[model samples]
Target: MTAPDRFSFNQATAKYWPIPELVAGCVEAGVGQLGLWREETNAYGLDKTAELVRDAGLAVTSLCRGGFFNTPDWYDENRRAIDEAAVLGAPVLVLVSGGLPEGSRDLDAARAHVGEAIGALVPHARAAGVRLAIEPLHPMFCSDRCVVASLGQALDLAAPYPADVVGVVVDTYHLWWDDQVWAQIARAGREDRIACFQVADWITPLPEGVLLGRGLPGEGCVELRRFRDAVEAAGYTGPIEVEVFHAGLWARPGTEILARTLAGYLAHVD
Candidate 1:
């Protein structure tokens, strides 16, 4: 089956694919969009990478991150992230709210700080024409990665800002286990807070850290299509990005990964 028009290959899915080759692979495979990561872009020369994708006629669906409120340089770093998103012509900048501060177990304070941090960046994000998309990772990551674990909490953090400026990311891999997810998705649509939609399956016996343990579409247990339908039903008509992070998948050639991603997307997510 052919990939749907909205299918976008997130760079993290092929973690080691060189930027130029990844762009070329997407072009050859008929994929029109991509989700880029900051580290790769910065290493490749942000301007050069932007030029490469643009010249190749590819659109950047979103940029993988700008938030980590617990850091000392968060404000400045996020401002730069906004600038990078603008340069890449990416409308959304996904924000992974960093875990609690050192020696701090105050979940309330951490999440609260995230809200305030986003508030401070709104002006810059808006000026740069980038939407800050708050991403809620799984609960297992709460103390070390993202404190925001549920879509409801993400929406709450986004509620104080204009939907067009600050929104939330709906990543199936991080959210598939929540029973209230369906309702939260609808609420996100009604509030116009669904800025980005990502798809990935959940695998058992996750490797240590669970950061690189994600499975590709149709590889594990997530109801990929159910999520697609939920997001679409909530009025999200943007690109459907397949963003899996597995060591095994990343070891393959970029072209092969893209082919498999497309196949799985068509079979399970599209």
Candidate 2:
């Protein structure tokens, strides 16, 4: 089967696009899907942001994020995020399971915390008509950002939950280096756990302590075509969301970045 024809640009990459203008630009660019940020949605007012996206005929691919499972008050925060996602008509609420708590060296403990938190949020997310997309951050981010470091592990945590309420985000930048990624992707597809598929290239020697360093497609070492093929072969036919987090790219004009990103994706991805 042919891949879906929609591709989306994450607003986070266009850090400069004020809400309304970003919506307009997304529409103008023929982008059918969008990833909304809580801060931006709040800045524009949830209703207004949702209206803008709907008016522009854009589909809410997935919300920027929910879940910092390591925090003492993580449950409340994640529940609120689920509500916000519902307000925006976003079907999936991306979750970044937070880092270890202060004085905590047990990564396994942190992971258990994430699983419990997700288990609690499952019903709320289901009630809100939103699916929780567990984003397995790169191993590089294990210390300070997220404990979900592999698709396999994320799947393990999600196994007990209903598929309609919990799934996974296959961001190439994070999972590309994983030796078992292909198998996990296939499993996610088989289980219908592929909620979102994002693309970004991997760059090394990234700034210490920051897990946001990612490159535009074709600008780094990831085998985008192979990855795309694997995802597609697994029966996931969804928008390919471009989410580069490079400081330099963010500084450039949004249009330039969008154009380059689309071109790179087309040139380097299958």
lDDT of each: 0.94, 0.85
Per TM-score, the best of the predicted structures is: 1
TM-score of each: 0.99, 0.95
Instruction: Please estimate how well model 1 matches the true structure, expressed as its whole-model Cα lDDT.
Output: 0.94
> After superposition, which runs of candidate 1 have C-alpha atoms over 4 Å from their true positions?
none
**After TM-score superposition, what is the CA distance of residue 170 in candidate 1 from its true location, in Å?**
0.3
> Poorest 10 consecutive residues of model 2 by lDDT?
1-10
Q: For residues 72-101, could you state the per-residue lDDT of candidate 2 as single tens digits?
A: 888888888999999899988999998888
Identify the runs in model 2 with alpha carbons over 4 angstroms from their true place.
1-4, 204-210
- Model 1 reaches what TM-score against the true structure? 0.99
| Per-residue C-alpha lDDT of model 1 across residues 1-270, encoded as one tens digit per residue | 455789999999999999999999988888999999999999999999999999999999999888889999999999999999999999999999999999998999999999999999999999999999999999999998899999999999999999999999999999999999999999999999999999999998898768988988888999989998899999999999999899989999999999999999888887
Q: Pick the candidate with the highest lDDT.
A: 1
